[model samples]
Target chain A: MVEFTPDEMMTIAASRLLTNDDVCFVGIGAPSAACNVARLTHAPDITLIYESGTLGTAPNVLPLSIGDGELCDTAVTTVSVPEMFRYWLQGGHVTVGFLGAAQIDKFGNLNTTVIGDYHNPKIRLPGGGGAPEIATSAHQVFITSKQALRGMVEAVDFYTSLGHGTGGNDREDTYGVKTKGPTVLITDLAVWKPDPETKEFTVVSIHEGVTRDDLQATCGWSIKYAQDVRETPVPTELELNTLRDLQSRTAIAHSL
Target chain B: MSLQDAVAKYIKDGQLIALEGFTHLIPHAAAHEIIRQGRRDLTAIRMTPDIIYDQMVGMGCIKKLIFSFMGNPGVGLLKRVRDSIEHEYPSAITYEEYSHSAMANAYEAGAAGLPCAIFRGFLGAELAKVNPNIKHVICPFTGEKLAAVPSVQPEVSVIHAQRANKRGEVLIEGIIGVQKEAVLAAQKAIVTVEEIVDDFDDMHPNTCILPHFVVDAICVVPGGAHPSYSHNYYQRDNAAYKEWAAISADRDLFAKWMEDNVMSVGPEVFEGRVAHLRGAK
Candidate 1:
């Protein structure tokens, strides 16, 4: 009984998906936290590459921004932005592109651009940085976001990153996207995996204490559950302590 | 050379300008100089249009913004950017948006003296549809389709670095972003440094050095990249970035902030702002 918040559970679950062999292109925010947590715990050898060009960085405290001096100081190597985007990312060296988005569709397409029309927007969001290329160039993609009806939308206003276009093999067949887009979606309420045949995201495991009603309430689309959905295991003591320690250190470092 | 003279000599109204630094070593002091000089109708370019760009945009200095991402780094939304794009506050501005990859490659292409950059990107994304710059080309070598965009050739490019030698050669260390490419791609380049030393005797082998031939002017402005760290010199002013979220939310407050901090100050003011954060390493 270590107590953990839903956000902590989501981060831990996302971290568990990474392995030592994976070279992850990390987005800032929750994805960065998850990737670093994995390095601190199970996947010690995971290569963490920030878009600012820090490669294999092992920072003790989380960076407030991607190009923090800590990332460069702790990195195995730092390359120029052009070389980073061209030779490393677009060259297909990254195994996973961990991302966070403002809105997601049933097919897992993302929208970080705007909340409404392209010409006129209800809310003009921070547009896609490296996501468009990372989504296609990485071997696979993993998405983490807090669950809400507005975020889990029926359709994205803009496709900032192609996840699985219109379901099925559309990402590969139609767009010639060479990578597996959005294989997993980890949220506060549940763990979702794309269907093998259709590529539509389906809930495979609900987090502890979250019911079908909870999932249905947060999601915009009609809920689809796997036949044998299971409860996600609670966080282990080691995982809890490691995560808390990392977060506290990050808070202190950023506060300065 | 002085920062004021460099900016005054190289920059002009309604010109394409790029002030590039990823998250580190952003040319904040130079940007403030641009604002103070009241340069209007300029086209600003950057991969991540951080706080400096936000300040410029809010002050009605820019007419067009050609960028990839617009935010306050890890803090939150850049409210001024949102205000301009969403409500046309201050003034209506046009946007030429692209992914970070495309913008980086575009700069690379510009540096290499090419017309357009061809890459495998924007496959299923909506950016291809909105940005007319994001075109498509068929690779003659392999018949594979790819995205293409015109090279980013800025009329003037400015960057902040750690140090420079008296010979006017600039040395940039730690997180060497697209500064080199941006400088090469621009018609004119200005570099602001923390200090000038005799030579780079004990520099790291991998450090980027801009030969004096490529650099148009060099100005020594210590702590020029405040709010954004200068690698070994100072830590990032995260509190200022967080405070900006609220300060820029209100139009009048943003105006007042500019008037107090930027409109009335010279480049020398930067050193005082980050005196405590020096020797951060």
Candidate 2:
């Protein structure tokens, strides 16, 4: 058994959620790593799309930016940005929207816009580039973020992307969004899913060696555990080695 | 024509100008020329407002910024933009923000001569609450509500491409972002290219070509997209982008860097900056 860091474990867990049938709209950092890892390991035929208009891209190394030359060079086809957004994303062809968040709420609403007040911000985050549409337009969303009290907050400063609004039928009833906002959240400590009734995220699987106290300490709100809480399967040797190789190749390519 | 003349002729003060590129093929040289020529009170527009806008905003060249996302790409915060918004350094600038889909559709609508862009976005986001520009309209066909924003019709659009022919037909290859929509949406367009050939032959069939008629001027500036990249011409300067995060953090250092790098140099220096990265593809 190969030892994996918490980040690698989280990535592997996230990657396992994806299958070959998913046409994933990938965000740049953790989601990109997970999607690529899944492609290399189990899901070889997963169609990866970047917001930079690369369709069916298969880069040897991870792209430093969404529009890195490698994405285009290795893409099956590259379209205009307007067409990428209008036809592919808004046209509702994507199956999964993989995203990251600066702050997430109990309802899985995300905030990547600002920290404090909108008029006078304590920290002005990189505003949502493509997540807003991807959240509502895709069939479903999967979020990955390292857990901390500040990040896993009770409510976000601003709702950059709507997960379930205030739970229940808020996604479809209140906002007219038909897609499942956030189906699963893969964090370092646990795997969470929204309650079918309330839509508030509840811990379903705790990673090996992580305690309920560990999850509660990092989460802002009171944590909820599922009745059949299970241990997340550890990263397989193939998953660990494949992820490491990808990172090493990415480092070498980006260092140039 | 020279880049200097083109910038002076097409770009004006207090105008809505879009320097459109995604992460790839950004018009850094043209932005430098705009800075060197001292254009002021402009409202700059882009989808990702990459480092070029950071410099323009830091230099006090812009009074307003219309963008979806403003960041240093793969790197972290755009410090200069953060400083201006958080601390009001240089001067307080106004902004109108949108999601990337809204902005892209707005540009598309502008290019199509539409009044506004209507799309299914901002469903439950707070951006629509803050930015009144993000309004709602019911789709007449489905009776469903959709997001609507006014089309972005810029006075001028500037971009960098891989090549252009002697007839001034520009070719943009890899990651052909919203540059085409931006150019067509603008009243005037300026394009900088690596070189001008007699004709484009042996090129990929799907490449985007802006015809000579739509383009107002073509400047043959080699390595025009330094720091960013011109696809098939040079690689993106990731080091420079990483270095900018530190340099743009300080006001004095940013000014000095701008003085030494942009204001003091001609477009010719761009070619030398990317000499090692040439033919990187």
Candidate 3:
């Protein structure tokens, strides 16, 4: 079995954060992969809810999206967008809302908007399908994205998802947004958490061979890192091989 | 007012466009205009890229598609993109199954001019490979990078607004950013409205959504935003959406329907059709 390039790092980090009892709201792509990994590996009993209405889905392969046939295949029950949000996600059935972002800010606010002015802008982007609700209603949000200065900015153009809600994040209290807006942002660089006082994000740890200054300089605002950071453990070869093999096979299947 | 004229007035060939409304909301009238014009080899980017993708693919109007979700909730499979890939149509179909949160982050990242946004998703999961075209971008700041995103600048966008002027100043609410961002990101746009409001002060200035200055074409067609609600105007027809979902497959039937309805109808005639549907109602 071959290992994916990021599988080793991804598996180790994902497994460490997840617990067996956690009910996760799974997205498509990488988020789907991670949730399934947790189910297959450490968190075998983890309850996974997909946006497309699959409740407690246990697919052998990752689904393409919430619409994947695999999600509706034998091992699943059904739900609706409204029901999924109310009963499964906002109903307090889920503990973690796993998401990914296109752009992130120092305050942890995100933007799925355009780069320039509000009207007559430059590019057209996909409007929030369910992000607003997911961001504001999930128990707690766990964000994942590839690390880059362009994405990890000081401010985002629009608040596509209510990650922190302008620092007054009343999500959990007022909206029952299960997650604390965005509790953590896991990337290739390092792990990040919100500052207790400011509610802004602060780098908690850098992966092996990554430096502290490097992480700080990437932000558009004056970034800070957690005081006590620790080194992450290396991933097992078995996990790595499985991830790699899955990716290669998927690539062949999708022809990407 | 003929399909050819409608296509000329509202739709353009080979443009990165936005179809208005929601999953079951807007009918994507302008997208149909594009099909009637026989505009081929186009790239469309949007959320759930359905009606547009399906019609474009079936009609061969779309050469490639970049989208987050492209399927109906429980009506079966991702028929369009999957079928294209499976058949090896020589047409490229890129599927980005990013969660709403993740896609927003990517768009945010692209808008911010940052390389990537950090979030928790299914990391070390199987899709890291299945959709392999997704690349890893190095973080310029931290010297750490993964799947960094580039800014997406759409050339044209077609949307349905509650109200618009002859010049195409649109008005929407709640998630104005969605409309605002699409306007800002694309080079040009077409605004199709149910009503052409006389004054801009009708909806709070802040909620103007998209200004007329950016709009190249402002086609005033009452009830044109069928499928997608025009703010306070109308609500989505769930029955029609169900019908659409059921027939998303059966390419031949859809193509023929397009020829009979959208392709045969004129721009001015859209009004008559909407009135008919309402009259029947």
Q: Candidate 2, residue B21: CA error in Å?
A: 0.5
What DockQ does each candidate score versus the true complex, computed on alpha carbons?
Answer: 0.92, 0.90, 0.04
TM-score of each: 0.99, 0.99, 0.51
Candidate 1 lDDT, tens digit per residue, A127-172? 9999999999999999998999999999999999999999999998
Query: Model 3, B1-281: lDDT tens per residue?
Result: 23245457655666666653333225366766676677876777665666556667766777667655455432334454445645634255544444443444444444355555444332222223334434455556776434433445567766666666544566753222234445555666666666776777655544545666776666666666554334344433334545665465565666567778677885566565445234211
The local lDDT score (0 to 100) that residue B81 gets in candidate 3 is 49
- By lDDT, the candidates rank as 2, 1, 3
Candidate 2, residue A251: Cα displacement in angstroms equals: 0.6
Model 3 CA deviation exceeding 4 Å by range? A1-12, A168-179, B1-47, B51-281
Question: Which DockQ-derived CAPRI band holds candidate 2?
Answer: high
Which sections of candidate 1 miss by over 4 Å?
none
Chain A TM-scores for all candidates read: 0.99, 0.99, 0.86
| Candidate 3 structure lDDT | 0.57
